[model samples]
Target: MESWLEKRWARPLYLAFVFCLALGLLQAIKLYLRRQRLLRELRHFPAPPTHWFYGHQKLLQDGKMEKLEEFVEKYPCAFPCWVGPFQAFFYVYDPDYAKTFLSRTDPKSKFLYKFLMPCLGKGLVSLDGPEWFQHRHLVTPAFSFNTLKSYVDVMTQSVNIMLGKWEEICGTRDTGVEVFEHISLMTLDILLKCAFSQETNCQINSNHDTYVKAMFDSSKITFYHLYSFLHHHDIIFKFSPEGHRLQEISEVLQQYAEKVIRDRKKSLKDIKNQDNAQKKNYPDFLDILLSAQAENCDSFSDTDLQSEVNTFILAGHDTTAGGISWLLYHLALNPEHQEKCRDEIRSILGDGSSITWDQLSEMSYTTMCIKESLRLAPPIQSISRELSKPITFPDGHSLPAGITVVLSIWGLHHNPAIWEEPKVFDPLRFSLENSDQRHSYSFLPFSAGPRDCIGQHFAMVELKVAIALILLHFKVTPDPTRPLIFLPQVILKPQNGVHLYLKKLSK
Candidate 1:
């Protein structure tokens, strides 16, 4: 009786083991087929030297910017790079290759942008297909020419407040002042007042004790998580210390954004408030999101509203701050160009403190310098896109579907073949005659094609207003002894804060 029972149980156990083995075999076959297809597509492309385990990821982690620069220079066109087992890229620097990629219906790389998903959510940057188009359409009106022109006053107010502090403190300091510190705060203040319709002065919190601190802390932690080996795994990242702090900081940002949305909701309900707000002629960013919600409740929610606000705040401010700081730096290094820009501003404004929309449009020389600065040090240096479908280039070369492509903004701007003497800080390259000579894809600090930055016009207006005011008031010169290093962070930032000697111009 005991032997018969043992045989009955053993029969069931044997069948279970065999079933598990068959499932494993099937999974192996699927992986092999997928990997084989990818390899076939990538077979002809050349890549930089890669490690067996580290691949090219170590270069990012070890802070090897020079090595990466050398590789890009050597292969100043389409070159392959491996991040890991599945993370491969044809990092393209050639303008033609870039145009081909940009022209297609490529999606943002999910693996590269994984870290940002926690804070930015599925805002315009992450959204795809009909959802992306819908959100983009809703927000487009807020950035119309007439609407952005009105925000110049707000930006001027913020810049004046920053300049007041700079003249009092930084102008008196022996070694000039840290430009990035002051400008970053001012940009945040502008973003809150103009974009969110929140009138708080983030610059007043100079010590960065409030939401400004949260922004910096969270960005740093998220960038760290992006490059970390262990944290690449979501499960592992969740249990890590950096992950914990990111969660805490993200909550602070989201809660702050939610507060703004709630306040705006209350204001919209009041009849008297609506009349006064209508004087601005156009709705702010918050209003657009809320209106989208009313049209189709399922399309945009309170969560989406808060997420986009946070995304804009983070994306808009940090990037512009870096761009403006770099602009001052380059102009300072080239005093002749600085004086010319200042002279142009003076010619247009003629002792006027505030800049009109018409006057802002007429500052051609100043705009050229700004474009040149952006080319040399684009705030967002590199961006990635993944192919949703196969593409055949003009050269008859093809890239199969499901590959990530890196658009190296810095590389294209500095390519010798594309730009003559790429690193010589020449603003004349942006002159109308010279600019028209280059390929459309050559200077893409704001990127190109369908998904180009929507806030670019607004950004240009703000930059012109702020720089025009700064030049009208002060002369900026780079400190010879204190050189700055531009690091590739969430935005390109100087390793040591940008220190420039701000000499108040004689009236």
Candidate 2:
């Protein structure tokens, strides 16, 4: 009786194990077939030798950009880069190919961008089709020339605060200061003042501000999530430690945005007149978003408002910080160009005490240097889009619908086919004569076409103001010991911080 009972239990357990093994094997076979199909479809585009299982994963480990550049050199216009056995994207660096893809209305890649939804929600960065168009229209006025002009004084004040901190640091630190950390805080300060009209004193206290800490931490975590395949699924990531931390950060950010919105709404109610409120004070980015909601109650939900606010806070501050940091790095590396920029700024503003909107345009040489820096170290290294329909490139190579394509801005900027001695820092490359001769899509630091950065104007203005003020107050020189190793995260960041020695200039 005991033996019979044992056999009965063992037979059922064995059968269940076999069933599960078969199911798993079937799933594996299905994925393998899908990989084979993708390989066949992308056979036309030549790619570097990739392992059957690992694909190009090993090659991209330590120095991703260096490996990418090697591939860029080998391939004429575009090439296929596989992330895994079942995934690949066409990395297009050529101007003509870039134009072909950017000009289209392809939706952003869902697989890549969906991870951002938890933090960003359905903000402009992730929206598509009619919803995207509507949001873009509503937000465009917030960045108008007149609106941006009003923020110059606020920007100057923010820059002054940062400069004051640097002045304090220069007195004690002879070893050189890491500018990226300081600049990141300054940009965040500026964004808060300009976006919500709240002064967080992030640049001064730095460590005491929870919101600022959350914002920076959130950016790092978001970048991690983008690359971590194991944490890609929503259910799995939500339960993980990193995911829990991200949730905490998101809550802090959202609560802050909500509070700002509530306060602003209450103030608007007291005014009782939208136009009068606008006439009294320049409407901030948040005000513009609120006004849009007032005009169309059906659209721009509360969630949408908060999402846009969070998006601006994240995208605005971080990207600008990276751009400014790299610009300083380039200027430090090339003193001649730096001096030229200083001379031009000195001629415009004697002490660089203040910068007006009109004066920003007058810094022509400085603008060229800024453009050159952007070309070399674009804040956004690459942007991907999922093709809504079959599309053919200028080279006659085509990708079918549903395929993802990555427009490599870094590759384009550094492509030897586009620019001569692309690695060398040459501001004259952006001169009017040379710029006119280049392809329209060849140099796209802000990206090109319909889906370009909405805050490009705002960013340029802030960059000019900060660079001018800093250059006036001190002479910047690169720290030779801390060489920059480019780490392409969500924003292009230096693996080692951007350290520069500052010598205070005589007033």
Candidate 3:
């Protein structure tokens, strides 16, 4: 009787196992069909040969840039790039296509950019629709020309500090210094002073500062999360080591922002302190945020404050540093253009004095070279958006609603069809006569449209100030021994750090 009972139970268990196996097979077949439907929908766009399961991931594993360029050359306007069997997006490089897509009011790609929301906290970079509009409207005044003009002094001081450090390094070492490291810290210093009026001396104490270290770590972790397929799921990533580390880093960043807000709020409670703050040359970004909060506590909460603060801190410093580093690298590689830019800067700021607001516009050639550098190596190589409505490109290609489109800024800038000898670093391309003749969307380092970078003006002013001061003080040349390999992360960072020899010029 016991043997008979065991046999009956085992039969049920075996049946249950078979049932589950069939169910799983059905789900797999469903998923495969859905992917095939997507592929058919994208049939109008050509793609490189892809594996049945791995897609383009294997092809992109080595020499990603070269493969991308190859695709660009073979395809016209846009092509579908599959990340896996189930995921794909059109890699759009044509200026006309970019202009058409960017002109729309589509939200950012939820699948791609949502990864940043945990780190950035729904700031301008991630927000959409009414909420994004509200936040943007509230913060717009902080980046006004008057406020940016007041920031010039702060930028000058920060640049001078970096240049001083380089001076000391030049005295002792005949070798090239890794500029990206110093530039990153200096940009962080500048952002701190301009954003919060706080001086942490990060450039000097960089190795020891936990906040600075956390900031860099957060960027790396975010980039990792973006590319790791297994970590795409929230629950899976939360249990992983990177996720745990990211959580810790997030807490550190949150704590830092909170402390600054708390201190500023406490000081503002004092009437004397408020009066003094009002009497200052101009209020910093934090002051403006606080003022906005005081006016509309219901609209702008502490959470919003923290998000914007963290967003500005991370986005501001890193991107600006990349732009400055690449611009200097390009200038180093092309000394003739570098010398011409120096002459323009020298003419604007005689005796190598502080770069003033009015003089910034006078450095026309310098500005052109900066634009050229941005074109060749845009800090943010690509941006993505999800279509809310079906749209047809100028070339008669169309994409349905809900499709994700990646605007390849790097590809657009380097397209031979849009530019003559695109790889050549020629600043004349940005000259007024030449610029007016080219497509407006051909060069978009800061991107284009309503969602373009809000801090672009602030970034431009900072770039001009830093480049002017550096050019005035040193003759920069590329380190022949350590060639740069472009690596696209959160920004287009060099795989190896940007190494340049800085020879201090006699005053």
Candidate 4:
């Protein structure tokens, strides 16, 4: 009886040990497989030096773009280059490969967009397939010309406020102003007035200005996501300082948006109780979004509403400012071109007047100048796409699936084959007569196809109004000492911030 009991107990213990041993071996195998895949992906890449443990993390600490330009230029059209052990990417300097990647809406090409996922959410920029189609459809109406027109009075109001401040300063001496900072606030004011129906003049804040600080914090996080390939992975992001700051800023902005949305909803409810055309009178984007929400109760949640607000605020504010600043920089350097645009603006609107959208559109020379500025200094400098299936390029080189390809805007714009005398600032290239002869995919400042910028029309309107207002009051001359230095951010902006001597024009 004792011997039988011993054998029974031993049998159970032995089985338990075997099971544990099997699990241990399986885990070890899984880890080994993961490392092996990382190694294999990295082996095909152009090798950068790494520490014994951390890999190429240090190379991406700062000045990432400067290093990346060197890599892209050196390789030209190489596939699957390593930033570190975790990433294997492709760089496409060739126009043909770039076109294929940018135009395709396939599932594979969509994965390269994962970088934008955390910051932008699965918004239109990050989404693919059915989700993308649905979101794109729902959002298209918000950017229509009629909807945009409702916001013009607000844009004009904001510009007048900015110009008032500028006039105060420039009255005494030749005010050497940093135009980027001025333009930045002008667009911010426009976004606030249009989207949230609030006025936030961030240029001169009485308080410590937490809102603008949060905005800069959010912007820094976006900049980090764009270029830091190795740290862009989920694991590294969780531990980053910027990552923590992003969460905080997101919370702050979310709360602020919720308050505005809630207030708007309450106002609409009150209007409904009263009845008639009073409710329909409100024309701001906030009113439009709230109206849509009321009609389609099942469509979007508070999260979605907040995200759209954030997207518009960020997109509308920076892009328009970047466009105007670069245009001024180009015009400042080229006085003949400056005179041409001024002459055109003067001819169309005359002095001491406001511009309507139709009037702005009719100013052909001004439009050409804006188009040319976008060509040379595109606000969004590079776009990245991934390959899902192995694809062959026009040059007959093959790129395997899962490698990222960066479309170099600077390279493409500078390519002599595409544009005549590509370096010179010539708005004439975009004139109606010359536009027909231009290549279809050559000029992609706002990008091309369905995924291009939604706020472009709004941007153009804001630019025209601001530019017209500035020119009416002040004639900008570059200080002879400070020639414009090209400092590239997410937008190609002036480094010294377009220091110009503003002589107030007599009425």
Clashes of each: 0, 0, 0, 1
Model 2 lDDT, full chain set: 0.87
On the 0 to 100 scale, the lDDT of residue 353 in model 1 is 76
Off by over 4 Å in 3: 1-23, 59-63, 172-174, 271-279
TM-score of 1: 0.90
Q: Rank the candidates by TM-score, best first.
A: 3, 2, 1, 4
Q: lDDT tens digits, residues 177-259, model 3?
A: 99999999999999998888998999998999888998777767776776665676899999989899888888888888989
Q: Write the per-residue lDDT of candidate 1 for residues 1-507, one digit (tens) a residue.
A: 999999999989999999999999987788567556666787777778788656677776655556666776787477777665545677788899889888876888876677887778778877778888888887777788877877888888899999898778755444488889889989988888877766676787657556788877766777778666557889999989888888888788887887778877787777455676544444677776787788878877888777778777888988999889999999999999999998898999987576788998898989999999999889987888888888877677788778878888878887878887777788889888988998989999999988999889988988998899888888888888888787776667788899998887666
* Between candidates 3 and 4, the TM-score winner: 3
2 or 4, greater by lDDT: 2
lDDT of 3 at 72: 83
Q: What overall lDDT, based on C-alpha atoms, would model 1 receive against the true structure?
A: 0.81
TM-scores of the models, in the order given: 0.90, 0.95, 0.95, 0.83
The collision pairs in model 4 are 108-388
Q: Candidate 4: misplaced stretches above 4 Å?
A: 1-81, 107-119, 233-236, 276-282, 480-496
Q: What C-alpha lDDT values do all the predictions have?
A: 0.81, 0.87, 0.87, 0.69
Comparing 3 and 4 on lDDT, the stronger one: 3
**Could you arrange the candidates by lDDT from highest to lowest?**
3, 2, 1, 4
